[model samples]
Target chain A: MTSASVDESTRLAMYRDMVRARDFEQRAYDLFLEGVVQGTTHLGLGQEAVAAGFAAAMRPTDMTFCTYRGHNHTLLRGAPMPALMGELAGRKTGICGGKGGSMHLTDVPNHAMGSYAIVGAHLPIAVGAAWAGVLRGTDQVSVCFFGDGATNIGAFHEAVNLAAVWKVPVVFVCENNLYMEYTPIGDVIAVEHPAADRASAYGLESIIVDGNDVEAVHDIAVETIERARRGEGPSLVEAKTYRHKGHSRADPGKYRPDDEVAAWLERDPLTISRRRLEADGVAGDTIDAIEAESMIEVDSATEATRNAPPPDPATLMTEVWADGGSEWRN
Target chain B: MAELTYRAAVARGIAQEMERDPNVVLIGEDVAAAGGVFKTTEGLFERFGPNRVRDTPISEEAIIGAIMGAAMNGLRPIGELMFSDFLATCWDIVANQIAKTRYMTGGQVALPLVIRTANGGGNRFGGQHAQSVENWAMAVPGLKVVAPSTPSDVIGLMAAAVRDPNPVVFFEHKKLFAAKQEVPEGEIVDRLGAATIRNPGSDVTIVALAAMVSVAEEAAVVLAASGVSAEVIDLRTLVPLDTKTLLESVSRTGRLVTVEENPRLCGWGAEITSIVVEEGFWHLDAPIVRVTTPHIPLPAAAELEDLAIPSSEQVVAAVQRME
Candidate 1:
């Protein structure tokens, strides 16, 4: 049964965001196949709940820094789908003005720093942002999203240590998709549960959650985010999940076994959330309506991106220097 | 005017800026209690407190990344890399993030940050410690590079760098930290991208930077004795090069000699020469000469280290060769 205190409209809004993320990713995959989108894409096909759940619990003023596999993260952070699709299409109308492709989408107004292509590069940056917020006496909290592989980077250790020592208001969420590219988690990392175990090492609070369960992630994220806002320092939320797609467009995923993909797909967040929604006496027609509307939204964004203009040659010289002096000109 | 060493002047500049702007802070190794490896941050932690003047671990990437993040969030952070050679560890953040953030952000953000570090080969600190990497920073577009040779210039230029709205790389020559001069009292601001004429002469132009400015001045004196009047131009800032002053000096002299402590191959000297030939070709008489260190790692032995870097004699010889 749906919780009595949970407002129906709020639940519907969350469902809408989930559908938006799923539809956006599906459309992105279709466009990739159609050769309309260039460059490699890392799809969040099944892990939509983690981004939707966590982002829903956050305030618009809170900052987020994510990794390259961040399409869902950007979408859930309130970025316009058209801008994201336009960026993926390499058009000037896109976020970052098409300079940064999918892996580097940034919308500062929504408090989303660019998703760094380099693994673990944004860890220290997130920590620094949190430190600035704390020093400035702001209640804002900064969130960092990275994969299990990023835990091995030197920046992760250094950043976490500094955050713990300074008691900076920040949360580090590791989307442990059970694989670092093609290598299984157990093969590369010595620790079984990386984020939970690593957080304690830095003397910070740690929580482990079922990343596929939207309610489960939302509950824990709400607590940790509040603690950070209260200046209780940083916390690590290890969300255990799996990626439905290959690491990038190039990989056919021959490395993973068929049974493994089938097992993860069975517990996909979107399907689970839909089942929960239907079980709560949401009409089948309403579900269909939501799906139809999301499809329309995604389709329009695709068309808009298709017609978007390519960056002008003169635009390349711009944004390099803040003074507008063309240093590239010989 | 107050008499101070180059290191003390730099320390005073940082301390004063930290007091002036709450957003301006200092982060580096041993900057808090120990006053930095070169004492360039002396008494900063005591004066500004640890929150503003913080000590960092030996992680160069973290230091630079923290600075970039803080700067993006509207803070003027002056990060120190201790030795210029250590910059290699954080090259990705410096060359990619800090340098490209403003451009990539579509001018929506400004990285008003400064990275100050000591450089040069006179200390015999071995290959890892001694280096003149100004050329590497000069290659980056968004970064403004400054290397002051005197205490007066150090104080003035550092104040300007802290107030600048763009990222800057302030290269402090370790050998010149103890060199003393009269620093002006109160606040002093020197314009970035402007070269200072150290010695006005008529025969030839000698362009130099960092510790080499003193070498050029000494060489000018030596040249004056031989009836070769050499104009010494200290290129205080490398990236936003003051081509106007350099061209004027070169045009009047008709001969040019660039000197640097870094290796000759692909050094700042080459960039100056190319710019001169491109913009002021008609002013040239003889081929532009460059006096630079040999392309070899600095040895630990004092004698060998002395041989590795350029000296006043070498600069004088290069000027003579031009004649």
Candidate 2:
């Protein structure tokens, strides 16, 4: 409905981004099982559409503040697969040189403003970036991504209210995947719609969309991001979706009913996007090639990351300050 | 040279930086129209305007979070967290988010930010409002902790903190707001991690910070009457600590005494004494002494608070006891 519509080429690009995100997450999950990736990782296995759609709608100048489950968003924002995987594996060739690990993937040049692990911490930081645009008279927007659990936190309300009053260019996107860590989000949140329902309190329009639908998510994102750039103020969007896998590594997700899991799996975001691509008269061979290419890229990225060396022991003593060294004394 | 108050230097220092750069902004609760809770930023709102000088809701997390974000982007934000004691509300933003972002990002983020708070006691604002938390910031990595004693040092150190390519928590002592000094005209910028020797002597080395700096100075005068010449050193910054200056003075004087307003355990004095014991062990002619507040919440009553924080008499007693 907006002037900046998604054309045919853009559609193919979004689909390709979705495919790559899926393949990359699958490979990363397998690596986690093999213990090649240490610590923990949160994946967007069934929630790839939100990242692909919103990232596709955003400009390169606009910044992104995503949560810990951020591999899909980072890749969709144009970060190389190898660098992201290398970061997950804690290698010297990682995006942050093995400093950030998986939960804090950041490529500032690419506008991925790091993935924060805390529940509602980055919301205010995103508002600050947007406030910079208003002060500098720039058109750049700041996009913040969080889970359903973040809506209950105090920082979320503070950031949203401040953004509305300041009329800063920030679009807060909440991916409501029905659960926060292990508990069902619905059991905790009072309102039916977590993010969009609270938008009214901050004087923002309540906009909720099917996060599983790439086009639906992209359309709302384009509208809100443009609205922010035009100085109309912030918007809260709730994208209803589900996580195909558990919250973290080793969460089999046995809490959900078997029938519910089957029903949701049938409506996978990748499948929905692929189906729409076919309905749009795209050649079957073309879709097949895109999928194959994504698999090859993920395989290659995994191989390269596995072959990479661990970070230098000296790096532990570096980067504590801007001087590029951790020396506190002369 | 025009005499200036310690509180006025805060506004002047921010004004200098705001005039030099359009990207430098001030955001906090009651910072724009009402100046600030402590009136430290009295003139900044009028001079910088509302866009650059912003007032926020009583949201400490949002204020600090926004500062971190703006710093990472293009803007250099100077956040005023009314009272330093209120840092407990948003410690995650300061300790976890902004502090670790640069190091975790592997030098990718240059968070050029300054958090100026009304720090320390001497007011009847009670324990919740009048805590000296420079030691809290000193314990965290990637944070440059600064607390100035004099009005001129306030302006100079504020400029240095604003210009630094990292995050600096500039603590303006609440007790020293009315303290006056003949500050020179024109721009005055000072370096971080440098200690100034307030009074030069060779008998004993007395180190102190912020409000305690003047207490140590007064104690030096008292010790002088008793024929005990004491050298007083004001530690302007705590993070990139001036261990060189401290070691040089301790090596010459062969005695070290620390005067701190913070509680006994894990104060900045502990760090200083540990360094002296490790590096300046042979230089010591006697045991190093630390004059600090008792480990308890500062009371609102004048009598109780006077007994809690480190005073000039206590510094003199602790030093004479060292002899």
Give me the candidate number with maximum TM-score: 2
* Predicted candidate 1 versus true structure: per-residue lDDT over B116-177, tens digit per residue: 99888788789999988998998888898999998888878888999988899999999998
CAPRI verdict (incorrect, acceptable, medium, high) for model 2? high
Report the lDDT tens digits of candidate 2 across residue range A240-264.
9999998988688889888988988
**Candidate 2 regions with alpha-carbon error over 4 angstroms:** A1-5
Q: What are the runs in model 1 whose C-alpha is more than 4 Å off?
A: A1-8, A328-330
Residue B164's C-alpha lDDT in candidate 1? 87
Give the per-residue Cα lDDT of candidate 2 at B129.
92
Clashes of 1: 1
lDDT of 2: 0.91
Q: Which ten residues in a row have the lowest lDDT in candidate 2 chain B?
A: B314-323
